[model samples]
Target: MQVFGIAEPGAPAEEIEIATPELTGASVLVKITHSGICHSDVHCAEGYFDLGDAGQMPVTDAGAEYPFVLGHEIVGEVVAAGPEAGVEPGDTKYIVYPWIGCGECQPCRDDNENYCIGAKRNLSIALKGGFAREVWVPDSRYLIPVGDLDPAWAATLACSGVTGYAAVSKVLTEEVDRPIAVVGTGGVGLSAVALLAARGHKNIVAADVNEASLENARKAGATATVLTTGADPVTDLVTAGGGKLAGAIDFVNNGATSGLALGAMGIGGKLVSVGLFGGQLAFPTTVMALNQLKIEGNFVGSLPQLRALVDLANSTELPKLPITEAPLEAQTVNDTLQGLAERTVVGRFVMVS
Candidate 1:
């Protein structure tokens, strides 16, 4: 197998050849077709995440090693499977569920591998991911049939799509007609807007520092858009939300956005933070208690949520986010990570293998 990956911490990515793993038990080998570059990939390529005052959290903390492969949003076709695997190897393609965990754990048994009590073995972090010619999945169960979905778009469903869906699910407790703000209308945030609209939510407001992104959010079904470059972004978001927001999903959960999302929330409103954009959030206990506001953090979604998201895409004519494609080469992968880190890419970038 050939892969483009970081050879060492903080080093430029390059191509390397690795021997393909022999399948055993329920294991399956998939031929890579498409892989979407996520913002998290930028942090992975840099080998650490910014931890504000605490310093940097190395990717090694998540069990990543040298030559770390950095792509989890994968769409591929099964090329081979172990004798025990139920899937047949042919033309059928799938979205590989990357949040794998110890099978004996209760969370894994319940299909919520994202919350496994065991050490995290998530792909693109602890394991080799789709920035390669192929990927080896531990179990056939991790493969979700992609069916007729566009492979480029389907690649994102493994991560960004499900992440947005899972975060939006948290805020669904609010009335459908009430305003919900989606902060940082990047690929993931735009997906949340589309999902909210698909679920019949009438009031969806998108907030972003980029006017282009906010405009893209409007096309992705945002009922209103707030450019957060103003003197008071919180006020802008709140006004766009028709006073105060019933819920907010912060896809860019940093210092500014965390405050903007939380500040725009009304009484009893919930804020679901779903980004690796690192920063501490400071909120007064008095205000939190007085308003009965709830704050929650969300990681990438569980296996079940990914399945549901794919099903939703198949069944509904949801507004599509813009997608750009490039060849799955070493330089393309490196450039995509740089683009994400620089916050220049508007929507999803998929590398076709």
Candidate 2:
């Protein structure tokens, strides 16, 4: 098996050859077909996350070690499966769910393993993920069949798609008189825009500092686009959204975006922060109480949510975000990570095997 991985923290990924993993117990082996290079992979490769004034949190502190293979948004074909595994060998394709946990834990038992605290077995974080020709899944339960959708696009549903759907789902529970703001206009933000449109939400406002991202958002069904680069971006967004926003999904979850999201909301508005961009939340307690605003943090989502997203992809015409495909190589992987960190890439970047 050939893989691109980091030999040390903050080092560039390099190609290495290793013996193919054997399928044992309930383990299943997937022949990698497509993998999405996610922004979180940049954070893992750089080895730390900014925590505002508190300080930096090292990836090592979160159980990441050297010789790391970092790619979780995976789509592949089943090559081999253990007797206990539900999948069979042949041409069966599936999206690999990377967030694994100790099955006995309370969160895992409740199917919210992404919130598990006992043991973090998340792929690309703890285990060797899909940055290679082959990956070993612990069980077939984590593999969701990808039916009829393009494998390159289906690859993103594992993370960005589910994350965006989960974030948008938080605010879409009730009808709103005002537009819902989607902050950031990145992969998750664009996904939210498209999903909102697909689900019949007519008034959607997309906010971003990047013109290209705003254009992408517009293509993905944003009724209005706000270039958040003025002296008062919050006011600009609020004005563009017709005076007040019913809710805001801050996919950028940084200090600036969080502030803008909070500021652009009307009373009783909901703010769902879903990005791992890293920063502290600082807001006035009096305003929060008076406005009765709710700030919720959404993780990537549950297994059932992933299944629902898969069904949606199979059944509906999803927003077609830009996709760039490249061969999975060390240089390409390194360059893609750099591009993503610098915000030079507009849409999903997928590595084909």
Candidate 3:
């Protein structure tokens, strides 16, 4: 098997040859077809997340190690399966749900393994992931059948798509008559815009520091776009959303975007922070109490949510976001990561194996 992975923290990923993993005890082997490079992969490779004034949160704290294979957005064909594995080898393709957990924990037992705190068995982190020609899935259950969607696009559903869908789901669960604000017009933000439109949300205000990103959001069904470069982006968002936003989904989840989202929300509005662009949030306690605001943090969704997102993608024509495809090579991986870190990449970058 061939893989492109980091030799150590902060080091660029390099191609390395290794023995193909042997399938054992419910393990399923997937021949990688496509893998999406995510922003989190950059954060993980850098070895820590910026925690603002509180300091840095080391990836080591999450049990990440050197020579790590960092790609979670995986779409592949089943090559082999253990006797206990439910899937079989052949033409069937599937998407791997990467946020796995210790199966015995309550969250895992409840099918909310993404929230598991016991042992973080997440792919591309604790386990080897999709940045290779082959990957070992701990169990067949983590595999979800891929439908007619493009493999490269379906690859994103493993992370960005599902994360956006999950965050949007949280805000739309309640009655919201006013336009909703989607902060950060990155891949996930654009996904939210498209998903919201598919779910009959006609009025959406998209915000981003990059004008190109904002344009992408507009193309993805945002009724309005707010450039977060102004003196008062919060006011800009509220104004663009027709004087009052029903709620805001902060896909940026940084200090600036958080503040903008918090300031833009109306009374009883919900703010779902979904990005891993780490930072602390400090707001007035009195305002939160008086306004009855709901601020929640959303991780990458559960299995059921992934299923729903897949069904939704199959049922509707999802607005196409920009996609850059590259061959799965050492130089290509390094270039992709560098492009992402430099914020030069416009949309999702999928590596075809």
How well is each residue in 65-154 modelled by candidate 3, as lDDT tens digits?
A: 767888999999889999899778877779999988888889989988888969888888888878888888889988888878898999
lDDT of 1 at 105: 89
In model 3, residue pairs whose N, Cα or C atoms come closer than 3 Å (at least 3 residues apart or on different chains), thus clashing, are none
Highest-lDDT candidate: 1
Residues 1-353, model 2: lDDT tens digits: 67787988779998898666677778898889998999889988988877778888888786666788999999998888988987788777899998888777898999988788787888887778888888888889999988888999999998899998888888884564478999988678888999988887878999999999899899888989999888989888988888777899999899889988988888999999888878888888888899899999898977778999899888888875778999977888899999988989877899997
Q: What TM-score does each of the candidates earn? A: 0.95, 0.93, 0.94
Sorting all predicted structures by TM-score, with the top scorer first, yields 1, 3, 2
Q: For candidate 2, list the clashing residue pairs, or say none.
A: none
Residue 71's lDDT within candidate 3 is: 94
Ten contiguous residues with the weakest lDDT in model 1: 169-178
Kindly report which residue stretches of model 2 are placed more than 4 angstroms away from their true locations once superposed: 17-22
Model 1, 1-353: lDDT tens per residue?
78887888767778898777789999999999898888888888888989877889998988888889889989898899999999999888899999888777898888889888887778888779989888988889899999889989988888888899999889985478789999988678888999999888999999988888888889889999998889998888878878888999999888888888888889999999888878888887898999999999898899989989989999997666779999988888888887877878877899997
> How many clashes would you count in candidate 1?
0
Query: Cα lDDT of model 2 overall?
Result: 0.86
